[model samples]
Target: MNMALLPSMVAIPLGIAFFTYLLARKSSILADILGNLATFSILVISILLIKTRGVYVIGGWNPPIGINWVLDGLSNLVLVVVALISFAATIFSTRYMEQYTARYKYYSLFLLMVGGMNGVILTGDLFNLFVFLEVASVASYALVAFGCNHEELEASFKYLVLSSIGSTLVLFGVAFVYGATGYLNMASIGGIMATGNQNTILTVAAVLFIVGFCIKAALVPFHPWLPDAHPSAPAPISAMLSGVLIKALGVYALFRILFNVIGLNQLYGTLLIVLGLLSMTVGVFLAVGQWDFKRLLAYHSISQMGYVILGVGLGGYILATGGSSSVAALAILGGIFHLANHAVFKSLLFLSSGSIEYSTGTRQLKEMGGLISIMPVTRTTCSIASLSIAGVPPFNGFWSKLLIVIAAIQAGFHAVAGITILVSFITLISFLKVLRYAFLGELPEKLKNIKESPALMGVAQAILALFCIGMGLLLLPGPREFLLEPAVNALIQGVEYARIVLSGS
Candidate 1:
């Protein structure tokens, strides 16, 4: 089909990143227009890719031997999510970033990060995946410190340090794989590994890979930098970090490697379950105590990520243990569904928090009160996002969470199912604290003169809020078979991806 659009995904934003920095140096408005145009164009392209699938071998070289850009059920699913969130974030930044100077600089780094993430998703080479992951990670490190204040710099430094360690571990894992298989292409490595040849070296590589990606995912003990770095960045950037970044770079990578490369197993499933449970319980519990709006949202990112990890892990456990195919598919579907839902609503939550801060000049929930009347758009959109994340019906989150719990029960993991319910309730408790202290009480005297966020900011939040409401329809028959089923099949197929990818190549 339209194979040209594949490379253009990475190329377009990358080209704009450089051009905006140089040519639009003096014009913040020009930078904003250029950035929005780039992301919006990509969003249009990504949507058109709804039913498209193919592998575009780079430079006309044979794949499994040369670098390739592949589009399939899994990567295509992620591409739409990335493009949608990036477009909305760009729109929000047009107004939200006026508080800071040098919009050109922000736009440049922002685009670079987007390009890198696109590269990470599309590339078929494991080494190139690492390269692209670093490209995005490095750019994010700078963006976190864009404020240049003591807090921002400190947060950035912590992120850089931990992120670099993750990178080093990834590189070591890559080296181990290359040494074992003599190839860097993911398909080739998977093909070689599927020969049922398990060894100590491979085991070491798997451990390194798991730990490295876990760090990137910010799972539990590895999540210190997230709470700090996320709150330190601007709201749109915060949206990107919590919404898509961790999923693309962390959860997505971990799944791709474990399921497709090293192969999923009982041990891997158990590990995922342990780590996911810890992240889920710890994140929501800690979030209940935070008064900082963005910080609270940041912790929820970890908790939501745990849901994704847990659901997928459950699916993997079922598959590895020879459980029912339908049940395994349901669990994986739940995880992937949550991944997409979280991307939109979490981004909206951050944008809404940005709107509130834009109006009230503060982030403390205690400092905000009765904003529903004054900033109705922000309050309404924010409430939608809150309920969506809390698993309210007719919203995307509820359907996915329902799938996860049902799958867990069907798979005979009653305790895991119960834990999922516990996490959901705890999440509600955390958000209730948010609603009570921020939107339900009396407006402070100082905030009475405050106004709502600008039109563009409201537009961004509204787009995501609508998705928060409408995403539940993805679970309906037609859309479910067309969209969600492909993703589930990709994971269910697992290492067979090597065969599908090679045949297409």
Candidate 2:
């Protein structure tokens, strides 16, 4: 547990963000170097900290009295995911972003978003979490509208309005929480509540938190903004938003506060399961009918995220009902494992879509054809991503989805298991449409001269694609013990998390 290294995770990207904007304003190349350097540095640090855990107090102050950053298993996992996706995004942007202006501004906002996510992950208190969430949200809104076109502006504005509403709800939730417990530190609040001292204000705050994060996660009824925002953003930004942003800010925050802070109950767990089912069914249905490339992928992001929520929600329900701990652990393992898996394949899919659009200048399926013969790297990588997302054998998605299904049945969630399989089948059908229309048909006459994407873009896609294939290896005994199990234990520990944090271990 190296406490000093925890601050570096948040500080490096934040410090470099302004420096990149100021010093590289005139040089896109310099901006590229700085952005990649920052993300890469964090990625390396994240891997190093995987075996490390501790609390880093700010300004030599102690817990409940001073602001702190805690690096436990859960935060470390998210930090690694954030750093990895941000690094790959920066790499992909070096070549793909040539079409956009003010490259330094783009990198600046990108790092700011990364920094905010790190802050959200590392913060030991609820107030700082909200602040970081807003930082990341604001940056993402600007990036979505970075193109400044009518569609981009319109989408960004809608994202802004809806996301602002969500944030306000969260602020109100925080206020109610503070009023009830008189503490902003999550462990302090959890400690007080753990003595069976729950009340109405806390309950209201819980509902508010759930609704706010559901909107941020874009679950079904709260998901109208994502279809527009994701398609309108540039490819790398889209990858970041779909891959890690929603998970870090929405799903991870929601579950952490519920399971660790206020405490999970049967009612909340059932509500989560309901939301997961609706998002899975509705999102995939809508996606299946879309002919636009990025739009379809956007809808599937909602559906895939539902898988994660379902798995974890099932585990929470089991725990709340006094079910077997081993079964609950299995359920949570599936959920968090899927979280990591989705970040890899979905990011790869978006990058592949970007490569196709870069060379073909179109996002409509009708406008694409026979890419396999020309864009070999894009084709192979996209095919691998497509198979993974569809939950085909030997790819990462299958194992996670399988784990969820087995956990559902083992927990007597037969209906939930059925819906999970149905949604996956529909997901496969939708992606197959992408493959048949976008890659397998005769090459459009307009695309004959189109070349493969640049070396950096391919490198980025290849990096994630390899993960899409290899992530299943994490399910094995050693990696699962070191990586996935710690995260599951963190969530399952519930109020014990407060004890650990308060003890500074």
Candidate 3:
């Protein structure tokens, strides 16, 4: 396959989603087939792109002058993550969503979300990234309100209002950058900024980008929408929003602009570290007291994301201070690796919650007990995901957490390392509460008849459980070279990214 065909990986799905929406009322089966086929094809294309690294100029124009789509190590990794999770969610939704009406509309919105995430990851232009972010965010807001219940509508409206504010701030930042540098292309703007001295406009733009992304990422102060939004959505959509959406649209974009486009400095580094710590502490504290199964998991999402940002922020700080490259490399690797690992475990956790809700018809953790006896597959898979998220050994989360701790210590942030370890223990405690209340203990007499979820649900959860184990092998020398090294190098390269893209043009 020609490498240039990569952009179609996003365009095709978006086109089909509109078509699916038009035909939705006529034939629901067609919508399901189209949704599955589109996601699967994208997955295949992403795997192919992993082997071919280069830039694809959109509209036959090269970078610095025209829009381009770059497929490199970091992007290819995120693309694969998006593809795999979308495919699994589609399969789970096919059976799970039958309980609700209007299946075709659900599928259409789902595909639109997939397309928007692909565009966000692949786009080489800064303005284009903001456009795709809004596309995805709008779709998600509607999906959250799909139930139309009192709680669902309330959550969806809140999310839409906050998200609109965030997107507006991002646009405001983009306009300032364009006005100052006289360019919308990311590499071109970066090149111009690199040649000139710092000024008030660029500094203000940077601040806007940080605040805007922090809202999208659900960092401590901006997190009110996430807990409400995630639980109100139908289960599969919750999986998508929590699993990959926040990381791709928020964290990934922030890292790309801060490190690659603007050049990482001490101010940005300190800001990331402080926000990360605040989110980690506050999110977990809230999670521990929650009785709602999905809401607890949602709060943990914020806490885990804090770990990712902290690692990357530390890496940026060390690099700015002219410290050892090895320490910086480890910090970036831990952050990116955690991003991938969190996607897997968090999706699995949501899927398990969906299964429980499907069989038992409730999401209250306190109402459920001894589910393991009736729903064996769900019991086993949920246990694995819990262990993984709690940072137990031999699971994917353990290695990533260990790396972050080591990197923090190596960079002379002893207090940060201490806090990271303390947070891991708190995570373990929270999961134990979940296990005791929801899975273990006496089986409620009314719930004894509840059975396992459908075959497809089991298959999806099992695939993720297996991945939780297999991903540990990524730390081994051979796999590290193929998967981990490239992404780490991408961030470590920092401002040199502009030079490379401009050179290709």
Candidate 4:
């Protein structure tokens, strides 16, 4: 296939989703097969795109004048993440969702969500990014409500209202950017911004983008909806939301715009640090008190994501202030590497929660006991994920947290480093509670008959668990060169991204 055929990766899933909707009532088996195939094909295409880097212009027109889909280190990395997780989720859903009705509708919305995320990552235009973001958001809202219980409905409505406000703000930001620069293409706007001085209107747009993306990412102050929404959704959907959706729509877009387009500065950098610190402190503290398993995990999502933003924001601060490039590079590398690792371990945690729910029919941590005896696989995988998230040595989280701490100390921010270490310990304490209450105690008589999840769910959890253990190798010499380095280079290059895109053949 031609490399430019990459757009077909999104198109095929979308088309299949619509077709599945039409045929879903008659033959759900067809929908299942097609959904899996579509996701698999996208994964293959994403791998192919990783091998070649360039822009794919829609309808044969150049960027800044026409819609463009750019594929570089950053987009390709997110694409791979989306494809891999979506594929696994689809496989797990095939058997897991058998208890639910309207299987075809479920697959259709799932593919739409996948397609929207792919579009968000690939688009090189601001308006197009918003459009795709809505596609994903709409699908996610509906999926959260798929069960349609009172709690799910309430959570979905809350999510819908908050998310709509965020989207409206994002649209307002897009309008301001268009009015300021007279361009919609990210590269074009970036080129213009680099040559000109900043102004009030652009500042307002930046604030709007930050508010909108923070809500999407569920940062501390804006995180009220996430706890309700994430825990109420089906396990696979919860995994997808926590694993990739927020990263793709919030952190990735925010960095692309702030660093690569609007041009990062001291003000924005400090703002990110403050927000990150707040999310870290508040999220973990609240998480420690939650008895609902998935709800607790959702809060930690905010906490861990704070680490990512803090690292990246600190990098931007160094780059903006003309500080040491090596220090800045270390901070960004830690952030990006943590982003990838969190996706794996967090998704595994959610899947493990789902496995428990499937076998036991409840998510309240205190109500369960001695699960390890009856559900050994779930216990083992869940323990590994908890260790990874708590920053235990040799697991993925420790390396990334260590990098961030070292980078913070190197940058003369001893307080930030201290806080990071403290938060890691707090995370460890919280997971210990989870292990004790949910997995480690004496097997309650009511739970004695619980079994391991079906083969597909176990396979999904195992794959993520293996990645969690092996993820430390990414910081090693060879793999670092192949995977993490290019992504770090993309952000560090900043506005030079415009030159790369414009100069590509």
Q: What are the lDDT figures for the candidates, one per model? A: 0.91, 0.92, 0.88, 0.89
Q: Pick by lDDT: which candidate is best?
A: 2
For residue 196, model 4's alpha carbon misses the true position, in angstroms, by 3.4
Worst 10 residues of 4 by lDDT: 1-10
Model 1 C-alpha lDDT versus the unseen true structure: 0.91
Q: Whose lDDT is higher: candidate 1's or candidate 3's?
A: 1
- Error in Å for residue 449 of model 1: 0.9
Clashing pairs in 3: none
Q: Look at candidate 1 and give me any clashing residue pairs.
A: none
In model 4, the Cα lDDT at residue 8 comes to: 82
**Predicted candidate 1 versus true structure: per-residue lDDT over 1-505, tens digit per residue:** 6877788899999999999999899888899999999999889888888788888899899866789877878888898999999999999999999999889999999999999999988888999999999999999999999989999999999999999999899999999998988889988888887788686777888888888888888989789989999999999999998999888899988998889888998999999998899999999998989999999999999999999999999999999999998999999999999999999999999999999998899999988889878988998898889888999888889999999999999999999999999989988888878877888889999998988889989999999999999999988899888688898887888788888889988
Q: Lowest-lDDT window of 10 residues in candidate 1? A: 193-202
How well does each candidate superpose onto the true structure, as a TM-score? 0.99, 0.99, 0.98, 0.98
By lDDT: ranked, best first: 2, 1, 4, 3
Model 2: ten consecutive residues of lowest lDDT: 1-10
Tell me how many clashing residue pairs each candidate has.
Answer: 0, 0, 0, 0
Which runs of model 3 end up more than 4 angstroms from their true locations?
none
